[model samples]
Target: MRRSRRVRFLSDSDIDSGEDDDDNEDDGDGEEGSSAARRWRRRMRMKCLSCKEEYGGGDAGTCRECYEEAGETKEELKREIDDLKSKVNFLRLLSVGPGPAGTSSVTRPCFYDVVLVASDSIDSADSECVSIPAHRAVLTSRSPVFRAMLENEMEESLSGTIKISDVSYDALRAFVNYLYTAEACLDEHMACDLLVLAEKYQVRYLKTYCEKYLMSRLNWENSLPIYAFAHQHGATSLLDAALSLIMDNMDKLSKQEDYMELVEKDPRVVVELYEAYLSKQVNTAASKDPKGVSRYSFQEKRYTHDMHMNNIIEHETTNGTEDPKTVNFFI
Candidate 1:
């Protein structure tokens, strides 16, 4: 006689429960093997399905609790109420174990640190496994245009098509690497570059991160290109948020000699903002010095004093030396 290769779960109590059936085991020779198989099936043990705590029965079979919990009758109100009660906790959606097929696990282990093809050996799963990059972000600089649109550096998305100069090449490489992996090792220089690349390439998540880093330093001097790009890209959300940010502090900023000086360069925006400020009739307490000089200052002062200013800026624009500290503000 042949035996089946597939083994079902088993339990000691199951063997005891089937003793009565064993009494009829020797009914006949031809039925002997079939009856044994049936006995074996009926006695096979398995774990409790719902609780998954130890207590077994046949494979694909339910335990007493599960069977009973199903209720003596579906319409029984007490059983229905009992069955409806669930333990409250965070809902875990991932399937949680090795599978029933081919004697293999259905999921990863607690100590598992990586993922790889089934064909790969355990040794190859560490460094060989794919993930985020480990280099600095592509966009590091702060910009006036990009700075005003962010609420949180980690969740903001850019609205337009903007390319970063003297930084795009490095930013693109770093940003693409980031997309494939979730990691980046950004420094101050390339933070904005990578951020702009993130925005340009639609890496919204990374762009958000860039925004956070930029917002800390965002000001009138650094938000223009990003704003231009935001408008160009039709980033309405970013544009509107930036405009609001600029307007919110426009009153305080108007009193800052340096901020106002640079802001006035954008004649179009200056007029618009001037009109808005006039409408509010803001009053500034930052009175000019006896020399009629402004008290507020630009943090990224290219020249400490006019005598020390350098004409060599990284980038030149229609207005003058293009500011390097552009922002991608999210917060």
Candidate 2:
């Protein structure tokens, strides 16, 4: 009879589970033959599906079918991502050329139909606003706010100029450029300012972009103010992310200047934070008592867990790629 190889794969739990299926056996052939067969089998290894490293059955992650399916799916998604990126680059190049001079023969820059003026500029008095030239079609397509204002023939559109309030010159320029190119140079302050603009104009993509930028920079130092700002702007994802970070670092909450300011300026937000913290503590306690004998009922624990998971999903829904590298705008 042909000898069957004796081997097992290793899993993360194998070290702790103390379960070993391979048994030392003395075949009728003899102890020496059995021992040599076992040694040969131990030297054999199969390539892992996930990491591509050689492993025995003990380290196997999934069946071969599932592994191949996963690999094919990953390749398909990668191809889709590349196609989308190419489309975005094509649109940007076609729309944002250097006016009539540098435009490709395939596309020409028509005279801009409307201008956006920044109502608030750091470089000028309140009465003086900086004007940014843009195409009406691009503005309307990128922003519902601009679409409404222009389609209704609002006063600003009738005059061929839109006055954007509570925005700096540089930020307005960046905003218009992003409308055309889907790119922005984001610092914390600029991200905050642009998030406001994105929210007001109902630009979902830009809002998500700025939220991701803010989330990346979030820490205990900026948590309170960011939490409050997110709340005020109706940015649910940013609000949840900031609130969760704040809850994890509750020990230092009271010492921060913004924490006190948040309590004074928006006491309701503070109350909400405390409520979240309490719910987290309750959930933690329930989890530790796995036998359903915790102070909180299983139903209550389940409800909190569901809510927490839903909040996490909301925050993760638009975890898109990072903002592209900063590029100069075509003024």
Candidate 3:
């Protein structure tokens, strides 16, 4: 019977002292024993490059080559990010507003060629609208509306003054700053105001920014008015998001005060909501049915239509008028 021998790898110092050759000679298995010793030496522990700790094959995240390549790529990306941040900071201009003691000595761009006045502030105690200074080149680059108005040599371009109506001073200032920097500190009210201004000026980037902010803050309580506002402003993404939230909470739709206000102000939008809800129900039913037949029956559709008609009629009767426009439910 042959006794089993435990395999151990020889260290560098052991090999330097001739212990490896001695073991091979003791085995007396010639080339085969030497090859086995080499294989045992090759089976050494691996260490992680990042943490510099010994780890098994199963615990290895990546090989040394891949780890080094990944490190280089990460450093390149960080450098690119830093470069972009510096470029943005350099391109941003100082926003123009009133200086200390209501003076116009604010540190703004030197070559600013235009002034925007909020029409709503024209009736203040001083009988003057606070002016916001801006550059025609920046405004034109940001919005085609400004481009057309300025490049046409209109009265605004000739006088170097533009009167913007229905906006407050703060909103006008923020709008001008965003045109220069593409950044804004948004709360719910500021988001709404900026969205309105963005839509009017056709600033697609700022409009999308405000829409994303409002979508992130969507809830059942604000859905109705937000949906109505989005619809009015043609904010398709925000409208779809708000409509989805409203669809999910259909049971509580009528209980909100905003719902009644929306119905009164824009009953057509309410009709569209019911239509969308019915369409969603039909789609859901069709998807669930293996035969692809919608389980939302005709009677159910009629019932939903009747519910919408009844609501409109109730509103009309309460207002004591038979306006055909109120009951017109055509999409």
Candidate 4:
């Protein structure tokens, strides 16, 4: 019995020894893995070149070489901008209108060859108009209208006095100054006047400038008149912006006084507004519907067709004439 018990104890001791060996191997592997993880973490940690702060690989933006290159590029761009500003300052001419003496300094025969007179100034018709002097080359370069008038040796060219009609003295002065310096102090009224002159003279730069100014100042109260004015002057950007504002507030459109005035003054423009709104609605409906057709769009089209038919019938009845050619349908 004692010999059997000794054999069992030896077998149990062998099992425990095997378990300790396996545990030692696992501990060695765990130590190696932890060491490797620490080395990897150290590699990922780096100082940011810009802020001088530690960050991991995931937080890194650019390498030191690329960051240095970006700094050089930014400095180069700043230098180029400064150079352009200097060139512009050098190219800009002095103001073309009256100087501190209340008479145009450009009137000197050596400096100026052309004079712009405001024919519709606030002054009485019998009074002499104030003439704003300008350089012919400057005017020609800025405006194609001036180029045509001057290069062809027209009556104004011969007389050296170009009479501008339907413009106030201040507006004409500002217009001429812009032709020289490409700069103007603009209020709403000045912007409107300059836009008209720019459109008439085909000065695209000034026209775009004035349009941007007006578009910046656009709001619900002034949108209708601005829309009408933009339409009249062919300012497409301003027109689209104003129309968008008007469309967004279509519910309140009829309540505005400007809407009444626009309806009375130009019914065609109102019709165009409705057409654009209907087109937008149709497009939205089409986008939402799977088959590219919507109930609202179909109903609107049918309603428009009925209105057209009614108009034609009413016209035929009033004139006591029948014309099949007048019948048209909206598709």
Model 4, span 109-181: residue lDDT tens? 3465777878764255522337665678878888899999998969988988888888888898888877866
Q: Give lDDT tens digits, candidate 1, residues 1-331.
A: 2222233333466455555555656656466656666766554544676767555444345667777777766669776575444211101111134345433342433232212121222234332222212111222223323343332332222322222344433454465445544446677556666765665546677776765555554566555444444444445555555555666675464454544344434333443444444433322222433444333432222123221122112112344635444211100
Best lDDT goes to which candidate? 3
lDDT of model number 2? 0.70
Candidates by TM-score, descending order: 3, 4, 2, 1
Q: Count backbone clashes in candidate 1.
A: 56
Cα RMSD to the true fold for all candidates: 21.5, 18.2, 9.1, 16.3
lDDT of 1 at 36: 69
Return the number of clashes found in candidate 3: 0
On lDDT, who's better, 2 or 4? 4
Flag clash pairs in model 3.
none
Give the candidate order by descending lDDT: 3, 4, 2, 1
List model 2 lDDT by residue over 251-309, tens digit each. Answer: 67768888655644554576577568767876677688866556546456556545644
User: Whole-model Cα lDDT per candidate?
Assistant: 0.43, 0.70, 0.77, 0.73
TM-score for model 4? 0.61
Expressed as tens digits, the lDDT of each residue in 1-331 for candidate 3 is 0111222333445444443463748655877877655554444345777667654343346655667778889989999899778646534444344566665643645576888889876666542337777789888999999998899979988998888998888898889888876788999999999999999999999999999999999988899999999999999999999999999988788898798888778877888888888788777777778587544484678587777768777886798765765546442
Steric clashes per prediction: 56, 8, 0, 0
lDDT of 2 at 134: 69
